[model samples]
Target: MDYVDTFITVAEDCAAQTGVVPKPRGGRDTVAVLQHRMISAAPYRLTQGDVLFSTWLLQQGVDPATVPPEDPRRAEFFAVDRACLRASPLPKTHGWGLHFDAEGRVALVAVDDPRYADLHDSAGKVVKAMRSSRAR
Candidate 1:
């Protein structure tokens, strides 16, 4: 119920000026998909790095099955040091919030969801996604 650390949480109503949409394809929102993959994969869950790689692949309309480790394009995805999930459109452009487990894996929590309120008050450390509009 107390607070110290902070992260940005841009609600859906606030996104129009920036032109960021929750789910550009009109299906599952990006953060939700990330959460689903992380949860289902469990012991093999993706680190933030993997999620960033996969998210971009999905956005590009690639066939997921076609991407193997040896694929030439795989290198292109990792060229960046890491994908800052905190700055991802999923949370900044969508209502989703992010929480990291002890192992540093991520799962999404919606800003309006009850769990968001709980975590916001939790002793555990959690951060809202950052916004492009503001400097950190």
Candidate 2:
């Protein structure tokens, strides 16, 4: 499933004052790093499903060459409910927001960016990213 005309705001507990680029750790790219790479490089080029699936594939070390876009594997992968962008670390901890266009394409918006407010106000729906920690 994808969010259309929606904006996912940063988590309430997010500490970063502005969007911070995620960095790889332990000589490997973390999920946050992988997600950041994808969305940052091609804003509005992919849907929430595409980003999640692609990241999952990468994490599983699945070769894209072997799994074409039309491959049944894609359908199988999405058969179960998966976490949405509101659960993404970009918004949860990295001070970034996720904006889903009318076509359901997604792009990152820094929390401090003027467009963050613009999109939040103008989007058809708004959802806050999942909190990073349990509420006190």
Candidate 3:
């Protein structure tokens, strides 16, 4: 399987093992939302780096249960706020961040100053494209 499949498998396994519900927000399913409202209100966008990271997570077989509660990756997977973004501390080159809202809607944020133009690409569209590409 590809990296995205691997990550999704791990996340799904983690949810199944923990009995965590896959909450949907704005038709997107996620595990948790960051507490900060400002981050939650932002538009849903995704970057090429975000897609790469998701693929990497899948390939590594990362599981939420295996990730430490304090691990920044956990926050990257779950939280949607500036604090979480700061905490995650992604490389300067990796400017995009992802999170879920209170309603479990998945959203993306641009971390680097003077964000890239493509960062505004609709997350839902990106996700759909990713899924379609993966199916092939």
- Scored against the true structure, residue 73 in model 1 reaches a CA lDDT of 69
TM-score of each: 0.57, 0.94, 0.19
Please identify model 2 stretches exceeding 4 Å from their true place. 63-66
> Evaluated with TM-score, which candidate comes out highest?
2
Per-prediction backbone clash count: 0, 0, 2
Clashes of 2: 0
Q: List, residue by residue over 1-136, the lDDT tens digit for candidate 1.
A: 1122333344434353332334325565465455345434552245565566666677687655578857766676676565476666656665656565555565555566676677678726555566657553
Compared with the true structure, what per-residue lDDT tens digits does model 2 show for residues 37-109? 9999999989998899889998999855477789887899899988888888999999999999999999999
Q: Candidate 3 lDDT, tens digit per residue, 1-136?
A: 1112101111111212221222447863222322122224443332223333443354466642354446677447445432222222121112334433233333443433232234334222222111111232
Q: Rank the candidates by lDDT, best first.
A: 2, 1, 3
What overall lDDT, based on C-alpha atoms, would model 3 receive against the true structure?
A: 0.31
**How far off is residue 43 in model 3, in Å?**
9.6
Provide the RMSD of all predictions against the true structure, rounded to 1 decimal. 7.1, 1.3, 15.5
Q: Give me the runs in candidate 1 sitting further than 4 Å from their true place.
A: 1-21, 25-45, 66-76
The lDDT of model 2 is 0.91
Per-residue error (Å), model 2, residue 3: 0.2
**Candidate ranking (TM-score, best to worst):** 2, 1, 3
**Best model per lDDT:** 2
To one decimal, what is the Cα RMSD in angstroms of model 3 from the true structure? 15.5
